[model samples]
Target: MATLARLQARSASVARQYYYRNSVVDVFRKKENDAAVKIQSWFRGCRVRAYIRYLHRAATVIQKRWRGYLGRQHYQLIVKLAYYTMKMNLYNAMAVRIQRRWRGYKIRKYCFNYYYLKAYLKAVSETNEAVREALEEFADMKEREERKADLEKEEKKRDYQARKTHYLLSTKQIPGVYNSPFRKEPDPRELRLQKAKPLTHPRPKVTPKRSASLRNWLECTRARSFPRSAVLPPIDRKPCQGPFRDIAEVLAQRYKPLEPTLRVAEPIDGPKEARAELQRQEWTRNVQDKLFLPFSSYHKSKKHIPAMHLSSKYGPDSYGSQHFREKNPERWICDKDFQTVLPSFDLFSEYGKLYSKAGQIV
Candidate 1:
């Protein structure tokens, strides 16, 4: 019963103190009332002195009430604050336990893994050591064989030198190889000796036959020794001269017919089949209408064989195709009879005036 009454009284006291402090702070803050009070105090000095004394007493009470309020609030919050602190401490302790257990588990796993790796490494090291020992033994055996070969070679070289000296001194002619282990010229020595011809003249028995055209081509391509000022043979010239004509006429003349201008007649969104058919027709027209070349369209009735590398740039890494073809003639078949088979200038001219139009011969 006494504790309950004390609790009620304590709460009421805290409320009264909080309200009283608020009212005092409010009164102190009012500028108008404060100025009026100060004016009135100047007029009534004794009453103003008594009011000042009362105000002093109220300020002391307010201060004491504020201190008591703070103490009571602190006392009330202690249980809750302690509860939160205990909760936080418990959480921290549990987290630490979990972290320690996890760390222990990880450490144990890591140790097991490390042991497994160490065992595997030891096994590998043992295998490597065995292989290394075997390799060492093999290397020693090889060294011994190599040493034996070296000794034998030295002895053979000494014996050969002695034989060579004796043969040179006695017969005054270097003897042929006698039971030599080392390599000599004309590799299979016996057959080379059996079929040996005199070394004085090294003359071949049969002369190689060659095609005249191939020979001429080879001679033309190959470098020949001559006086520096000597004239080289020129490429074959045109057999006949071109008919005399104005340069403007020759340049302006077109060998191929001018293509007719195409026009879109209407905004026609045709079906797939119709568009495909139109594309096919266009392709056929393009194929039928020959593309003109300066040489082939004007001179040859037949179309010129377009060079595959006409537009492509050949870098220095690749050899010129013309030179490659001329050098490797076995890649082609040649006629021995026709040494000068190329046409002359008469082929291009049809008896005088140059025709601007092409013939549909091809």
Candidate 2:
């Protein structure tokens, strides 16, 4: 019982301690929250006051700009109105001046025309008097000619009547014979049978021979010649001789073969192993080591093979190695005994001739 009580007392003490701690924490937190709220409120108030001041300044600026704009607009309006009014007055004055000048010109023109008409009418009247006298003479001549023509016509009619009477008396027609007005005698059979020449001959199929006149004209033309003032370029017609001995000698001296820097042994002889080793070294240095330079060994970029490059199963490096024949027995066999030989292309063949000499395949 005593142990249980002690345990209970311990629990009670722990509970009291937790309560005190929570109360203290709550009190501190409340104080902190209150202080924070006060500080935030103070900052908010400062911001609000600043914003209000800014708004006042902005409003003042806007009002000032608006007022200035209005004043400028009014001034421009007044200036334009004055300028337009003055311009209108100037135009009115110019219009009046132009009108006066035009009216004066019209009056002067009218007076000139009136005086010119009076002079023209006077001249026309004088001309008309002469014309009237000439017309009377012409009328008298016409009347006399008409009378002469009437007299001739009467005499002709009388003579014609006399002739008709004589012809009627002289002509004796057989009774009951009807003479047709448009009758003509039949042509002789010989004349009708005669063949007439064709008016137009058929054009020759062959081209007509050049006329004598055209030939003569061609012969008359002189040969064409260049103008005397024309200048012609000089041309060297003589065949070129061989180079001069002096030039040949100079060329020989200048372009002679360079002397050997190091003497190369004739009939070169070396051990097969050493030669092969040197060849291998050269192949590795030239083909393998430097072939793909400026690129990492693991670069994914492919090597660009030329269109004409031959593809082989064996790698290029192996071709240089001494063991190439062993590595690629088929290549060696083909190179030596089983070489492939392509037949020569016959250009005369149909397909071959499809490609013209100009390399165009049409």
Candidate 3:
């Protein structure tokens, strides 16, 4: 009985121990599963945050690049606008300068005209006053002489009548001398007639027709030579002096047919050919020191040619050789290894030949 009871108790104890061990293992497994689930959730959350951060960073970089591109484009547009504005300002300034010069020219012309007219008027007034005084003196002298001649004729009337009758009959063939009233008249008692000396001087001859015609033409030419103020007014006693009507009149006659004013026309745009020529000249100058001088120095020393001949052929600065190479590079080749292999000949002759060949090809 004692052996049976001890075995039963030991079996129960073993069963209880196994049950506790299994429960503890179950609890450990549940805690471990919960920890694993929490860990996995945290890991997943971290990956989502990392992905969001990466997206935000990429967006910021893209926005910054876009803004920079836009800023550069706006800056370029502003520069172009400024350049155009500057060009227009320069054109306006040139136009203004031209207008100012034209205005100055007009003002000078007006001043000259005003002064010249004033001087001419003063000269004309003086000439007129002198003419008037001379005419008045001549009139007074003529009146006195006419009265003396009348008194002498009255005193010798009778004598003069007798002499006149005799003289008329002797010198002329009268148609009816006997029936004339003057033949019957008696001479005045106080008359004492003096024999008149034969009138030697004939009536002043009238100008020939041809000479009369030329008089006007000569007067016109004379008038053109002098200023208008120099000419005197026509007076009965003396002829008018000098040529032309006045200074103003003379100037008007001379200038009427000419253009009144001049203006500068706008400058024409340069031709494409001319622009190309300018560019070519600029390019030639840029390369001249670097290329032509070195080539010329090498050619003169190596070829044993006279400096004068080289200068004549290539010009003082080897212009011909450089020009030839620039215009027709295909005709002349330069080896990379050989720095002094330029053709040895008169530069002018070589250039002439090349031009002739080119002309023929064209």
Per model, how many backbone clashes are there?
A: 0, 0, 6
Q: What tens digits encode model 3's per-residue C-alpha lDDT throughout 306-345?
A: 4766556343554474433333445556622222334444
- Model 1 / residue 23 / CA error / Å: 57
Off by over 4 Å in 2: 1-23, 26-31, 34-46, 53-69, 72-87, 94-113, 117-362
Candidate 2: worst-modelled 10 consecutive residues by lDDT: 189-198
Expressed as tens digits, the lDDT of each residue in 139-176 for candidate 1 is 99999999999999997765555543432231225434
Provide the clash count, candidate 3: 6
TM for every model, in the order presented, reads 0.20, 0.24, 0.24
TM-score of 2: 0.24
- lDDT score, candidate 1: 0.60
Q: Assess candidate 1 and give its TM-score to the true structure.
A: 0.20
Better of 1 and 2 by TM-score: 2
Q: How well does candidate 1 score on lDDT at residue 147? A: 100
Candidate 3 wrong stretches, greater than 4 Å: 1-22, 110-362
Clashing pairs in 2: none
Please provide, for model 2 over 1-362, each residue's C-alpha lDDT reduced to its tens digit, 9 standing for 90 to 100.
Answer: 99999988799889999999998899799789999999999999999999999999999999999999999999999999999999999999999999999999988876568767899999999999999999999999999999999999986765555443332221135311122334464233212222222234469699765332323322326542212233332343332344322323333443446443112332223334577888898777674454432355655466745344454533555545644233445656454333233443344333322434553443
| Candidate 2 vs candidate 3, lDDT winner | 2
